[model samples]
Target: MSLPKELEVLQNFFVKQPNPLLGVETIQVLLFREILDFTVLRTEDTRELNTVITPLSTENDENVQRVAFLGSKQKAVESRQMERLLRTAANEADYPIEECYLKDYLCLECPRCALYGGTNASASKTTNANIKHRVAYSTAFSLAAFEQIQQTTTFNGISDLTVQTGQTLNERISVKPATIFPSIVTLHSVTWKELILMMKIILSSHKYGAESRIGGDVRNTVVGITGGWEEFITPLEFTMELNSEKEKSLSAENVTKILNKYKLLLANQKKSVILSPEQVDDMLKFISGFEIDKKFLTKAYEDVRAYRDVQENSKAKKK
Candidate 1:
């Protein structure tokens, strides 16, 4: 009912390395009802729930029907006493044992939709949604009893704890990294562009490494759509163009084409400024063009633009 005095208790609670598996948490519950009462305790076991729960086709059924219990794993760490108590509870509650698990935390099959009856859109992928929802729901319940303190605590509340659609849990959860002492932090809004851009940067940074990129395909697709200009060009090619001494000798048609390409891919509200073909080209050229400081120029362009805008705003205010 109350939060543990020690935060270590909370961490240890989740990092449950018991006899069988690693990273498991156990919860014991004593349920009380009108006439019949029972108790049950279930431990979080690291049995992988990787089953894909999708709609099943029933004969001429317009309502999307699902196989309620397909590929369900019975690999829970339940004590004999806990099992007995749960059995008693199921009988008294007049619900099937399966149903109880489905409703409770034991249901790893599907995600707990907090906004099921409210506003959140229907989850696109059941497995992915379940994983996210499970983490969020468990986290919410785990921190439920923590009294909300001001700036120092609580992430300001539940809303602050949320990862926007494209944002990551690790990034959103802590206002700042726990290691960072005393800094202002903003909870970032999740955007598809942010996710795509982050993925591209990551992949580009480490594609040479042995570690497989998780979201490379999505990132590529996004680049193709957003950076319509330089999709076919490799980073190497882009570098060449950026550093080419022949740009001055090139025809006006070619110059116009290059500039137009950049304009097309620049950041817009419809989408985040992804690595457009033009920027990719620009970056490549920057890398290749030893004549000019490509990185410096790009960064300087951004800095100058921001400074000029700020100055303009100041002047306008004065006026």
Candidate 2:
């Protein structure tokens, strides 16, 4: 998907929060399938688990017959060590557990292990590990929790998020969108720019769902594009509120209020007029793009311009 112009502003203009909103959902699924299928490599130190420790018999005679103790040696089981290492990697990577619906699934550590006596015991255990690995290896899901990971990693700058899944390695990465944003409103279609902007807002937030986590002092953030793509890191809670006609009207009003608040915040900061006049114009464009009222736009423009004049005058006096 093509990045939005506003998002490009954020990516190109902002030094601190530069990053594109890449397809997270596609990547999540790819990672999930690959991890579950045991085709994807998660860590160099780990290998696919073929079996687990099973108890044969407690009696010495029975144990001798069933367990067949090979002569004890100092050799480490490469597979076991790999499994252990993968666990450690997942923990360290802060792999996201949400996309795989990890929350709904039975916890691996729980008393009732689903894989313990299940017919496909080995398959079940591998499935669980794969889910964990998906969250761990996923560049998008990993960054959903803390904003810094998204900003610092090269996840989005890479390519179309595709992954292969099967009982083997030669599979193709699944073709799908990998995003954490919730679908509140159903539009016929969305542009790449729109997707990226929505993703930035979603990624900057805590999680994706009806209950949005896009929190913080909204005053400190601005929605725009960077690196010629749509992206945002703001405090506005973007969720599909009541999708009725009345709710739509209320949402429009809320947008007005938010713009006014943002304007006031800009005024208070007395920061450099970093945003160009064209960028300010784009804000108006976005408002109109959504069919929002022009009143809020006019008011915000005046306030921002006044701030710019103040900045310019201050600079002249100092000169």
lDDT of 1 by residue, 1-319 (tens): 1122322221222221111111223211100011011111112243221112222211222222111111011111111122333345346645343222322333222111210111113333222222121111010010001122101211222345563354233211111111100000010221121122222222232111011132101111111212211122222222223224454222324433443454454443232223334544444333233221233223322432343345456557787
Stretches of candidate 2 exceeding 4 Å from the true structure? 1-13, 16-249, 266-319
Q: Best by TM-score, which number?
A: 2
The lDDT per prediction is 0.23, 0.24
User: How many Å off is the CA of 220 in candidate 2?
Assistant: 21
Clashing pairs in 1: 25-44, 227-277, 230-277, 238-284, 238-285, 239-284, 239-285, 242-285, 243-289
**lDDT: worst 10-residue window of model 2:** 27-36
TM-score for each of the candidates: 0.16, 0.18
Candidate 1 Cα errors over 4 Å, as ranges: 1-204, 207-319
Q: Positional deviation of 50 in candidate 1, in angstroms?
A: 13
lDDT for predicted candidate 1 compared with the true structure: 0.23
Give model 1's TM-score versus the native structure.
0.16
Candidate 2's C-alpha lDDT?
0.24
